[model samples]
Target: MGSVVFSIDAELGWGFHDYSNPPTDRIESARPGWKTLLEIFETYNVPATWAVVGHLLLEDCNGIHADHPAVDGWFARERGAWRDRRDLRFGPDLVEAIAEADAGHEIGCHSFSHVLFDDPRTTRDIARAELETAIEVARTFDIEYESFVFPRNAVGHRELLAETGFSCYRGAADPPESRLRRPLEKLLATIDPQRVELVEPTVDKHGLVDVPPSLFCFRFEGMPRAVVETLAEDPIVRQAKHAIDRASRTDGVFHAWLHPNNLQAERDARRMESIIAYAAEKQATSDLRIETMADVAERAQ
Candidate 1:
């Protein structure tokens, strides 16, 4: 049988720290969705890889970015101490909840501070520091990360990841030809969502399993939002179910990923539930197997 892997980019505000005006309201609004995700996975007995930011596991920080590299010539602005920004910066409680969940989820690293490893500014020292800090912080919770998801999906520093004991990393899907291609594709998806390509996990030169993503559970907004919401069904759910079915028939891997923050509205959560329920149903009948990124990596090895 084929397999399906779900990976959640579980970074709170750290995902947007580089933005001039971070969406504080949206970030806070999505906090509850994290717990909702755990509950949903429990309901379906579906485990996922939660690639958490290292900083989120911290109780407090000095509110400084002196150790990390500067992105685009400016360092990440720390408004105040981490204590005051607990909702955004610190989330050990949320990480603990994922660890305590009954679904047997895997907690992996998403860098220390969402630093883009692919950027030229991110030197070897910076990359090493990020991985080291992430490993150190996760150790406090008795968790040893074996899966690494690059920040912003801008992959880099593979040797460092393998040296740090990570066995696998998620790779991006096919790149769009142009910037406009993505927005245009999103709009077109509202009409008829395409089936995502399935991949077989491959072992790279660095000895890390490359579990590339099949699709991103993109959130519709603006005009596309209106069109999607008015539709009789969810295109995202339809697309995911189709991909899962195709994977089962082809004996390939279907990997679906999204941010918990994407579950902003009730409808968004319902869409996720629909996709997971479909995958679980298929698994119950031996059509498809739901596995974590670590499981794929282990099997690939």
Candidate 2:
């Protein structure tokens, strides 16, 4: 059996969402959190992937349209962190900082405007336009991002990806429910990402090596860390990771990911560090072919 493929994603959106107020995580929590995680990977010499948003690469969009009812209401409802502010300007030089930090690492695409592909009319032209935007931003830093991780873990628009000249798509993974559903999710949540096998119909059916890691190893966005840590002892995350660890049918890849914002809590930093340490131990103990999304995607070609 070949080794496993490991990937990490830092989802850089515009903001976070709070049920009663705007999310306070995007700038304050997520960006720095990711910086710390990336440093961890660097220190361990771990080859990881950063599935970044194009908005983070571009110069902040200036001039908010608060006059427009829709624009004003959008930020009000979803107060989360993004690479840029609502009007397109960031509070600081975060965009440049990421580009500089991404040197020697795989800087992959999360889409130019994550919403473009969401459009039903996302033709090849529009798709390339969106992808090229990210490509162009990467180019500004002299980094060529060929790998792609679809925004929202939605990689259905393979047409756009392939049309834009991408080699692979890193999409969603199997839910823990099918196998040891409960326990797996719990353990995986704490130890590693709950990265089940890729059980969905994606680019693979069309002969593409759709690279997906185990997922749902943790609670998704807006879910509190207190709730997630409580569920760490839950049966779901545990069963999921156990299945992956002992599976005879494990593939050339073992992948899992989540937004860094999910780890915004004070204690989450410790939890995330533990997870990274565990993955490092896994690499030492096994011959698993752990990799960044870019590495596997390039291999698919």
Candidate 2 global TM-score: 0.69
Top lDDT prediction, candidate number: 1
Q: TM-scores for all candidates? A: 0.91, 0.69
Model 1: runs farther than 4 Å from truth?
A: 65-76, 79-83, 176-186, 189-194
lDDT of 2 by residue, 1-301 (tens): 3334444455444433312443554445666676676666556556656666665665545323233222123333323343234433231254444455533456677766454344455555556766776676677767676678776565566766665667676765544454565765544554543434433213555455577665543444334434755766433344344543543244445555666665566555555455555556666776545566666655665
TM-score for predicted model 1 compared with the true structure: 0.91
Q: Per-model C-alpha lDDT, please?
A: 0.84, 0.53
What's the C-alpha lDDT at position 243 in model 1?
Answer: 86
Residue-by-residue lDDT tens digits, candidate 1, 104-140: 9999999998898888888898899999988998999
Worst 10 residues of 1 by lDDT: 73-82
The whole-model C-alpha lDDT of candidate 1 against the native structure comes to 0.84
